[model samples]
Each structure stands twice: as C-alpha cells, then as structure tokens.
Target: MVETMRRRGSSKGRALDLIRSQGPISRVELAEITGLTQATISNLVRELLADGVVSETGRGESSGGKPRMRLEINPASRFGVGVDLGADSSTFVVADLAGTIIGRLGIDGPGALGPADYVRRMADDLAHLLDGLDIDRAAVVGLGIAAPGPIDREAGVIVGAPSLAAWSEFPLTAELSRLTGFSCVLDNDATAAALGEFWLGATEVGSTYASVYMGTGIGAGIVFDGTVYRGSRSNVGELGHVSVDARGPECPCGNRGCVELYAGPHAVIARAREAAASGGIDLEFTGVAAADFAAVAEAAITGHPLALALIEDSAEYLAEAIVSLVNIIDLDHLVLAGSAFEKVGAIYVRTIQHIVGERALSRHLQHVSVRMSVNGTDAAALGAATMVLQEQLSPRSLQSVTLA
Candidate 1:
C-alpha cells in the first residue's frame, strides 16, 4: 500500500511538470510521455481541472475517432507579480499561469532607498499599472522578486547588499506582502535570470546549463538536471565574487578583484567615459542604457575604437569567469544575458565561446555552446515574471524575483 501511495505522489508531480511545460495536451499524450495509464492521467487531469489549475482548451483533431479534448493551464485562475529590483531601478511585471505578461511598469530609483520605501513604492507603482489594465486584484497569485544578494531565502530578507546598502537585512518578502496583500518569493537576480532562460530559452544541448547575467552587476544561475541549484543557504552561482585579478580595484563586497567590479555595467561605462574624456569628446554616456546596448555593440563592430576597447576589456573578464564556471560545472551550454551583454553581446559570446571551446575540460569530447539569452534587454523583468509562473505552476522549485 505504501509503495502504491509513493507511486501515486510521484505521478502527480510528473503530471504537474509536464502540464506546466506542455499543457493544452490530451490524455493520450500525457499518458504516452509520462508512462502512466490513461485512466491515471485522466484522474490526475480531472483533479487538477477541478482545483481550477487546469482548463479545457478547445479540442484536437482525431485520428479517425472522437476528437480529443485539450487541457491547458488555467491562466486566469491564478495570477502572479514579478519584480526585478536593482541598484539603478526596479521593474514590475504581472503574468498569468501561461507565462504571458499581462502588464508591466519600470521606474528609476536610487539603491539608497530603504527596503520599506522601495517596497511601498513598488506596491504603489504595481497597483497603478494593474489599475490601468483593469485587472482584478484577487486574481494575483503571488509576488516574485529578483534582487541582488546575499539573500536569506527562508526569512525572505536581504542579508547584505553592498550594491544597495539600505536593503541590508530588509524583510523584503514579508513587508512587501503586507503592503501588497500578496504572497512573495525572493531570489537572487542572476538566479532569477537563469530560471527565466530555462523556462523560455530553447536549446538542443544537455539540460545542465549556466546563465551568466551582465548588468549593473555580474551574477549567474545554474540550471542542473532541470532544476535550479541553490546551494546551502539558497545562494549559489555567485560568479561576481570570483576573483580574476587579486590586485584589481577594491570591490564593495570586500573583495579586492571580483569579476563584477571588472566586467559589469559599471566597468564598461566607466571605461567608455574615461576614453571619451581622455579624447576630449564630451558624449552622453546615457546611451549605455539596456535599450541601446545593441546599437552600441554595432558601433563597436564597425571599428569604433573606444567602444571596441571597452567591450573587449569587459568581455575578457566575463569570459574568464564563465570559463572557470564551465570547467567546474561542465555545463554543456552557457547563455549571455542582461543589459550589459546587449551592448557588447556578440563580443561576449565570441570571447566566452572561444575560451570555453578551446580551454574547458569538457572540450575534450563535446564543445560547450555559448549563446546570448533569448530575453534580450527585457530579460530580467520578463524572467521576474516567469518567477511568478514557476511558483504558481511548479511549486516544487523555489521562486526568484520577490517584491522588494
């Protein structure tokens, strides 16, 4: 009897994952893929449907028999809110169960703001956006926050964020939940970006992969065996702290030479500004925004010396970190993501791919594929939304991107 019960529980878990990923599928398909009986699939689907987690979505063509009924996630049955909070700004995105973004808003705010002020402002901003969209308040499932580290995942607090000082020890999830009346999940920004790519990016390689995020900071998310690998204390894949130069600039994290301090947005912008100033060329560095990184990259490609130099320097550090990670984890694939990458993404991809393919231990047999993220400039925010979807659909895995 105990064996049977265990089997049943396992089947239900499989059903949930399969349906979450490829729902709008029929009973036959679910049975075939899951190796469960048709009757079992039907029973599980019915249970999910009755609980309002799944819904009937029209019908599929039949093979000389009755048409099969399609079942999909009930997106309207539950909703979620995703927020990407950074030192430079915050972005909120609302998505349904189907991972479709319903509404979004972005704002500029200094990282010096207290957690309470930031959460309250985010709540207010999100409310305004939802109100404009005429969405029902009760439909929101939970809040997912993508924040900088280090994080206390269980306590839902920001342990220490040097990049954003006021956020230290902030009760982000609980406080934000109180302000917004929605449950919240908090995770590291890079971890959240990796989840976003895992759920959204397509690849023919092995499931184990790394998502290297280049933004105001450098962070990475490791997707291992189809699950995010959060180490003890729910913090892992912190590539920013990986030292590439022991005698480089002092980092806010107390490290003398971390990858982030050398390769993140700050590094690139600082380099660009220095070059411009040295050449007596007063140009607007505001063009370094995420929305314009691609254009900057194009200019660099055309032999723009300053742009190319800055991008090359950043890419070198980035590639160094990624190569180290690949050697350790042996990830079959790597994704370059975030606003920083959008500007010099090709340079990053080329550098990382070349280094990994040439020097990684895994290169002895199979080459590690390095590519840009599918999310583009909006990836962090979009992945922030996917965090909500992950929570609502696959509660087995923890969510990234919390409210504060």
Candidate 2:
C-alpha cells in the first residue's frame, strides 16, 4: 500500500480516484480496473451517491444486454480553499470538487509581515473571497496552503522558507485553522502544483507524472499511479537542490552547484540584471523579483541574444536535474508550472525535452509527455485548494477539475 496516500484513507479513496478520472464509467468498469468485486464497487458507489459525492450521469452503451449506468463526481457537493503563498505575491481561491475555480483573489506576498499577521490578513482575504461566492460556508472542506519549504508536514508548518523569511518556523496551518475554523494542510509549492494538475483530470488515469515548478526556487511534485507521492516529511521533489555542477557555487542547502542556483528565477533574474547593467542586454531592470524575471522571460521569448542565452543556459541546468528525476521515477509525463515559466516556458520546454529524450533511461519505454499548465502560474494556488479537496472530497477516489 502507498503510505502517503494511506494517511488520507484508502479503499474508497482509491475507487473515487478511478471514478473521478475515468467516469462517466460504470461499476463494471470500476470493478475491472480496481480488481474489486462488483458487490464491492456497488457498495462503494452507493456510499458515494448517498454522500452526494458521485452521481449517476446517464446510461452507457450496452455491452451485451441492458446499457449500464455511468457514474461521475457531483461538482457542487463540496468546496475547498487554497492559498499559494508566493515570493512576490500570493493567490487565494475557492474551488469546488470539480476543480473549477469559483472565486479568486491575488495580493502582495507576505513580505516582512510576520506569520501571525499574515494569517490574519489572509483570513480576511479568504472571507472576502468566499463572501463574493454564493457558497455554503459549511461546504468548504478545509484550507490548503502551498509555500516554499522546509516543511514540517506533520506539524502543518512552513519551516524556515528561505525565500519567505518571516514565515520561517511558523505554525501556518494551526493559525489559519484557528482563525478560519477550517482544518488546514501545508505542502511544498511544487507538490501542490502537481496535485492541482492531477486534480484537474487532464492526464491519463493512473499515470505517473511530475510537475517541475519554476518560481523563486525549483521544486518537483510527483504523482505515482494517480496519487500525490509526498516523500518522507513531504519533501520528496527538491529538484532545485539537485546538483548539476559539483564544482559550481555553494548553495544554502549545503550543496555545491544546486540546479536551482543556476536555473531558478532568482538566478535567472540576477544574471539578467548584471548583463543589463554591463550594457550586455537592453532590458529595463526592476528590483522586484517577479517584474525582473518577467522582463527577462519576455526578452528571452522575443529572441534577445543575452536573454535567450541566460534562459537557455538555465534550462540546460534544469534539464540535468530533470533527467535525474525522470531516471529515478520513470514518470509518464512532465508538467511545467509556476509564474517563472509563464513567458519563457517554450525555451525551457524545448530544451528540457531535447535533453530528456536524449538522456532519460526510460526513453525506450515511451516518450514522456511535456506541456505547460492549463492554469499557468495560478496552478499552485489551485493545487493548494486541491489539497483541501483531496481530504474533504474523499469518497473512494480521484477528483481533479470538475466532477460532473
């Protein structure tokens, strides 16, 4: 049994994933896919239906005798709240079980605000977000937070996030839960993005994949057999910390030549700024990380020599780290996410795909699908909400995007 998934409960949870992803499917199909007896599938589906989690959408094509009834998730049965606490700004969203965003709000990052103060403001923003929607407050399952980590997953805390200093050693979830009256869960930004992608139901059922998130730093979120795989302590996918150059600069993570040191947005923006200062590039410099990175990303996409070179170089370092991840997990797909990738995504995608195709040991098995997030940079916030839905929307299976 997959232990990470076990913590969320199983049997029913597993069935729900199958139905959410492959529905409108029949109970026969569920039995076939899950190796459960028809009786078991029936019992499970009955619970889901009674709970208003699953609905019988319509009849399916007859295999031999009567057409079978198809089952699907009921989107409006539940709701979740997500907060993507980012470096430059944060995103707040309310999503139904279907993963369709109901309401969204964006605001400045915590900046120097202490964790307690930030939580209070966040509670107000959340109230504002939910107030705008005609949603039942009781229907919101809980809250999910995606942030940069050194996370204490069990404690529901973001421990010493290097990028968001005031958040370090904070009981983020407890505070949010206390103020908002909803149980809260916190996870790495990349992991949350991957879950958000999984929650969207855009991938093949039971596929193994990973999302590579480019933000102030780099991280990966892995999904094995349609389940989010949070490694021990929920820090499974630290792609940025993987070494691409053993001889390169020292990283705060106590690693030499970490891939993030070269490929992450901070490094990219820093390079662009130095080049622009030296008259090597013609981009306007903004001290703000998001603005600066966006400027570089825009120039790179437009084919400016210095901008392209810097981004491409970062992609090369990123490619090295990605190949390592692919070899380890043998993922079926790779998703590129985060605000950092919003503009210069093509450069990274093309470069990473080239390197992975050439180097990944699993190349003989199948081509790994690579693509941009449908939600773009907003994926983390959406995924944060998915984490909540993952808990509250549980019946026996998977729900990404919309259920009905």
Which candidate wins on lDDT?
Answer: 2
* lDDT per residue (tens digit) for residues 11-124 in model 2: 677777767766888988898987878997888789889988889989998779999999998888889888899768889988888899988999997777877887899999
Q: Once model 2 is optimally superposed onto the true structure by TM-score, how far is the C-alpha of residue 85 displaced, in angstroms?
A: 0.9
lDDT of 1 by residue, 1-404 (tens): 99887666667657766776787788899999888899899998888888787888888988899999988777677677788887766778877766667787889765566667777888889889889978888777788888877898888988777667777787889998899888888887888878777665354424788888766677888887667787777678789889998999888788888987777766666666676779833346564344334444665878787677767877888788888998898788888777777656788888888877877876888888888888765566767677776655565443332223
For model 2 the TM-score comes to 0.90
Each model's C-alpha lDDT?
Answer: 0.76, 0.84
Best by TM-score: 2
Per-candidate TM equals 0.88, 0.90
Candidate 2 — which residues are off by over 4 angstroms? 1-9, 37-40, 61-66, 362-365, 395-404
lDDT of 1 at 366: 87
Candidate 2 lDDT score at position 170 = 77
